[model samples]
Target: MSRLLSLSFFVLGALAQGTSPSYDYIIAGAGPAGIIVAERLAEAGVSVLLLERGNASTYASGGRSLVPWNITLTQYDVPGVRHYIKNSFADKSEYCTDTPGNAGCILGGGTMVNQLAYIPPQNVDFDDKWPVGWKWTDVASAAERVHSLNPGSTNPSADGVHYDQTSYNAFANFFSAQGYTSVDAISEPNSKHDVYSHAPYNVKNGLVAGPVMTYLPMAQAMSNFKLQLHTKVIRAVRNGSTVTGVEVEVDGQRQIISLNNGGRVILASGVFSTPRILFNSGIGPNEQLQIVAGSKATTNVTLPASSDWINLPVGQGIKDHIIVTLNFNTTESVDFLDTSYFIKPSSNITDPYSHGNGILTQGYQRFTFWTSNTTSDGSVRYFQGTCYASGQNYVSMKLYLTHGLTSSGALGITAAGNTVYTVDPYLNTAEDKYAIASFIDNLLVQTRKADSTLIYSGPSTDTGASLSKVYTGGSHWVATAKMGTDDGRVNNGTSVVDLNLKVYGTDNLFVVDASMHPDLPTGNLQATVQVAAEAAAVKILALPKQQSLSSSSSSSSSATSSISTSSSSTSQLSSVSTTSSTSAQLSSSASSTLVTLTTSASTSSTSSSTSSTSSTNTAQATNPTCPKSDGTTFTAKSGAVFLVECYVDRVGHDIAYVDVPTNRIADCVNKCDALPGCVDISMSGTACYMKGVVGEKIVNSKYIRGARRIS
Candidate 1:
């Protein structure tokens, strides 16, 4: 009813304000963080004006709701004799080519149609990498706010389950047998420690229930808030410390998108888009302005004194998780591969989203990571998210360098236009590259250990092939609007926003999104970025008019008093009650041993928190183990179906299976019959991983690829 009435009101309002819709606050992009900030401010009784480049129906895909990738993919790029469809993340949204950098020109930014998985970085990360005056406590509060503001935005299965829990448990157990530990986590902001599982979604029943559905809706309801779609903000109207409003494009016509001088302005545009906005306004790295615009420094938008020229690093230390995965298929018998995850996955409904679950829900043809691996792990070293299409469901194992060093990427405007950014992400650092290579090696090794022949491998598909410069740079990009001690390189190190999140030279203007993260975390960037936005908002609202702008001013008396009003009071949308998963029935002796295995597991930094610790039921040491199926040990065999495998539970899980290393798809199905429990498979090369609970010993079976089960 509310949805319908809101629709009617919007129509009437559009008829009324079609000529000119005024607003108090204007935000740039409509991605996850951008939507969050807009919603937060609007709720506080402030008029918010959001300018979105895409149309509203962007989130709706007719009645089908199927993203573009959901339909086409299989039509092309498959393995074998012909028509091999191998569309990696390269064809997803952002459509970044070898050169042309395009930001999502649609509403909801990336969130309207991203994997939509939400996570929070570990406590230690905020405590260490983020700037002074910000810590785990501050961030935790923010995460809580975002989730509370938008809770359970996902679809649960027809049954009670959310994802493929059995498969996840099977593989997770295998890791435990190898002496790994499990982390016990919760979705609430209670600050508990646990290995996180399927994070709650903002998708309600096959819908992309993100900013467009939640924050944006609430903000739109307020008479104080106004949203304008199909509009692009060119730059902020500035006259020193004061932002008059914005210059925007509406109906392909340029117009002055005004905001009250007293009302604020926010750069909610994403990382790529935000910096461009700043640069166009003559507020970025000087060298960038000169090179891109061929300008001798033209626009005088009122910057502070020359001494205030912060020689701070901006858009440096860019990083992302590198991924590697394999797959397998046989017949029907738990064919949860193509669709249908755990109908009763043994996880909490309030679980925070992550990768290790038996099957992934948040990732459309994707998977989550953190994977209890390296600490100070690999980071975004100048890689961009390329696209094969706007959207698709694919599998990938994202890897993070818990720590990043020795390399940096700069986001500079190129003379070509705002569309082309100088993507000089240096990925050849010996240490960083090698570390990436090693991580890739670990992925192959881990997957293979679960099922020997689970991948498409050959002369073309080697461990080194996974390290192809063409492979990755996940969505997680960070350190652009960074913090820390002022560095003279990469422009000014003196951050754009201070500890309280207020812009250094200006008053009221604030940057409360992923751009403010000083250091990239070890894993996905969404959770951490959102948390930063949360914390920034808390501080922003607490700021007194006079106290916020002064860098030297201590906390204001009024502001402090306001802060004291209610430390526990927050304006979050709602709260999610986390239910602890019923503990596994371990033998008393096994439980005692398990305690030691889990408690002693170490935690790494530079990534989001969630330790799926590998624990051993040493006492029972009799963890469920798989018996090798192929009579013979897995060897690099020819003309045979090989399975590349990994342990999800104690049992083996195939990454992918294939028929011929000789490069032929002739006998794919017959190969599966030769191996036991080989349910289904996806062939890439000669590597073929079985799809069942294959044992600890990865089997390399010998069979031909002829026919597969169509059923």
Candidate 2:
């Protein structure tokens, strides 16, 4: 192994100086990417530090709560209460103030605030936009892992039946009559054209569930994982093209967090904030960095000199789904469910948890995927139709134009050091405008054919030109730090990260979030972002060991003195280091170990493993030592027999159900065994559905069937 002593001295000196804590890996932003990466790294026995700009979304803070059928849960946990994040009650501290965008800053990031729409990106979404080593095949296992950890459900209600289907029935009947195929969107995730499906959400038993309910908990359970909430990262402490640590402010106290020798820093702070941090660190376009350096607002901090800057395209090729809403008035007979009813507590506020049934459980939105044939180039531009109950006796149909749209924007920093979208990515291209017009016209025709009573609202007669004026981003921003083979810093290219998601000019710095997406997907981005993080974890684990730099001189120049040097002393003395004095003083507070690195990148294909604490760690039924039958028997505490394909219905009018939050099949069986007269149980995605009796035999591929012991 190539051991460079200079780097080790820098780390040791930082620790000796006593400025801030040190970690093997420091991940920015506690979003999907950050949580997943932290979990994986911790599982590998590597020390990880995850930083978030917002506080925890716990039930005690009224940010997340669940009261079942009676009253809605907190704004962060309930599906119906999600609109509060975008309304007047929106917490400014938890959102980005630079632009009109809505990027979550909380512990779970967007997962805590979004509508929980969960759908995998189509194969084409990856095959078209991503470069080599990041195609659909590369991320397929990651997608499966995410689904297995936080599976989406078409029937999220405890009763296994969809509730308040007035809007759904209207849209489904209309679309089905017009030759649209109806399928379970979660089961068939890639079927994106001429198909209508229930809104597949990442909600389990009435709560907004995803990384917040799964990955975050598992990572927190590990001793090596550390989290810092309500902390803001200013910039990276870098020397030339290398980053050694980060400068942060926690509770108004400035500190410098140093990395271990040959340590790495992962930036998963979404698109806007990720680029903003890089720009502040003098790692963006020369002109953009000049703007920051010349700004009076940035004068308080010692900005890097122009000679030390690592000029790259930090913020470019930004993209978002363009949205257009179509409103319709429902008939007197068609009863519309009031989604805003959850804004205030209901009369049944004290009702017991009903396993996610009632209005608060579901997102109350039905979706339709359609493909447009009006494009002259024949590119695969698609549209997403989200019909939801809104206003008084009205249903609003939102049409989101996505996939194959060529419009893009750019992000830059202002003189005040705030991030801004200098160029918005809404209908900026001729092709996208044509596609939107064609999609709207065709959608209007379909609606008329489906239900004549449904009236048209604004933009009824206008073409794509007029609609462009009212279009808004779908809040699915991506590609600011775009990843590709082309280097944006040279040859008029436009990619910031290389194929491995490493910044073009840096070795140890990586971006594993939506910011690295080369293009937007056909559906929601949370699933794909998790997939990217999963793949990144494996790629990072496979890299060769990083060589540390060592030197005898105690000066900033000594940090990168020479590449050829050997030092046997593990404890070397160095008074001076490459980073500032603040970094040296902060490093003494924490201790970290050097992580083992693979000698070479692994050439094996990636596969999903369910051994993590958040997943079901069950032995495969094919094991010869295990009992073999049509059902997979498990070791349950209450002597339960697990049948592979059985279910129960009609507890309370076939509605009342209980879901125990446990990943182990055996533990789930034990919960069912403990229940009185609980004859049947169905388990899937960290939830156990218990029943009073086996009313009828129902086959469901998604769930594992279990039965209680008669003895």
Candidate 3:
């Protein structure tokens, strides 16, 4: 075994890229890739270390900005709630919220903060865009594996949108009339195709559910798995010629953790964070590191030599979906965009969440995604816009720019404590803006054909417009770390990893996030990322020990490099990774719900109609507030810090809601706030929704299945 790696056994090491004495595998970042990778290794009986920077999202429910408020029509815009939204991500770019992007600070990562749509990319996309050995079938199998772990429902509404179908059909038909196709299911994204499915939501029955609730928990159950939450991996530690482990922080204390060379280290951090972490570890270009060493950050930092920068590309190719919104008033019955959704100046924050699910309910979330046939590569994205606040409404049509021409962006740190990520994701090529404008024009024309009312006569031709402005960027970012056959170029490059997702230089490190995409997909990135991660996990598990043969120097997994290594460490690590994460949990299913009941299936008498009577009346409550499965009141008065409202078959039970008092909600919200395991939480009513913790103790309530409240 490498001496440096061996030192990790007992040394109080804190270096970024030096080898430690021991550990089988070390995973960085806690999103889907990290979770699934850790789960697979732990299941296999390998000793694994899962490092996450964000706090665990196990207590509260849904949005952090909304957590401080109560959930009801009365306290909709409570002063604190409004202030919370205003102060949310205050340090981030104003457009971070203006455009819709999910950059969460939780254990589950983006999976926690996302809109929760589920999807996969077209089989041909992988087959065509990727290099040899990367086939659509392979990725499809991986996607199947992922879905098995985190399956979504085909049906969202119980009775299937009685009054809501009209709006959807109208919106879809209008587009179909102009050559668009109406798909009932979400399709695997294709750069040149269009299809639909019910938006594959991470949420089922109005609950947030994702990987942490599924893969990570199963891995956690394994004694071999050691999870380190709130541990931020600053950089990779290395010896003269061999890679070692990572330097991380826990509770403000820095520690150097090691993984034997025969042991594998995977960089599963997200696109934005992954490359940044790698660069900090001295895996990036020399020119960049020289600048870092000169900064105040260099005092405590120990950077590796420039040769460690490996010539292959890493975080250069960035891609994503760019959304172009069009707003219009429908002639037929339409979800009131300005009324229930966008709030007025006079509206108090008291009645935050409206009762009796409004248009935002009724499957108003029903939207479609398609990739254009354009030869140029652009992105579908949004800059925080008017419709993106804690109280903003009006769902905009997202124009996904699947295959943009631009390559990777610079992943570096700012003089400030925060990481500064700058990418010409769009306008990276002469054809960039043209492709976007062209696609938007096509989408507007087609969608207008679907429903003439979905229009917003732009006062300005600029694309960045939000509900308040035009010509703003969309939030569907992807392709920061691309997958390809060869290292294409310097600035504009081919990719960093292979079609099989093996990083160029490394032995076992693989990338499976949106950044690994050579080009953007046909639709939203979550579905495609789903397919990619699933495929990567399966392929990784199928390979034998040291299976990688084509690995280059960039991926951190090369075997021929000038470095001392040991197969014994690898073997020892293997001993801890023999079991699969979901083996015991998958006794037919990972989660067992109480047979979800639709409104039509209900034999019990519960009022299904909405009343004109105001919620402030608090008059004549109908449906009995059934006791929580524990036969306890789930409301604030009951003293429960967290309440499980909606549940998905995420793990052992279903996705749950966490309801607590406004005073104590933040603490409870912090508990589950940003983790992918949380689905949704309602305030004012003082309830937090929690996912992934549903247990066998649950009792199914016919419950308010739709967005409507349980009056």
What TM-scores do the predictions have?
0.59, 0.74, 0.61
Question: Candidate 3 overall Cα lDDT vs. reference?
Answer: 0.44
| Cα error, candidate 1, residue 203 (Å) | 3.0
Model 3 scores a TM of 0.61
Candidate 2, 1-711: lDDT as tens digits: 011232333233223333326766789888889888877665544567788888666332223232232222345656656655466343545566665488888878888767778777778889987888888876764565566566667777665767667777776766776688988778887788889888888776455667655566445444455677767787888887777988888778778898876778889888888998888888888878888888845534446788888777778788999898778765533555443455553634212123345666677575555544437777778788777767655678778888788898888988877788888888988888888887766656655544454655554566545665687788888998999888987897788888767888886888888998988888878888888887777677556645642111112111111111111111111121213223432122222212111110111111122112121213332111101122334434554454433222122211223433324445556666676666665543344567666644432121223443333
Best by lDDT: 2
- Rank the models by TM-score, top first: 2, 3, 1
Better of 1 and 2 by TM-score: 2
lDDT for 260 in candidate 3 is 55
**Candidate 1's C-alpha lDDT?**
0.42
In model 2, how many backbone clashes occur? 16
Cα lDDT computed for each candidate against the true fold? 0.42, 0.63, 0.44
Selected candidate, larger lDDT, 2 vs 3: 2
lDDT of 1 by residue, 1-711 (tens): 122233443454344343434455677776667777775564444456667766553212111121222221111111000111113322243322212332355556655434455444566667656766687744543554444434442233323454544334433443354444443222332222212233334343223344554455444444444566667776666666566677777776767776553566788776676765665554556675444355324322233334433333444454445443333221112223332122222334213221112222333322222333233544323111111111122222333444343455667655543533355544546666665566556546654553532222333356743554544455556555654445334353546567765555555556666666766554445656666765565566455543222221111111110000011101110111112323322112211000000010011210222223222212213211111111111211233333322111112355334423222222333456556665444232223334554433311111111122222
RMSD in Å for model 2: 15.2
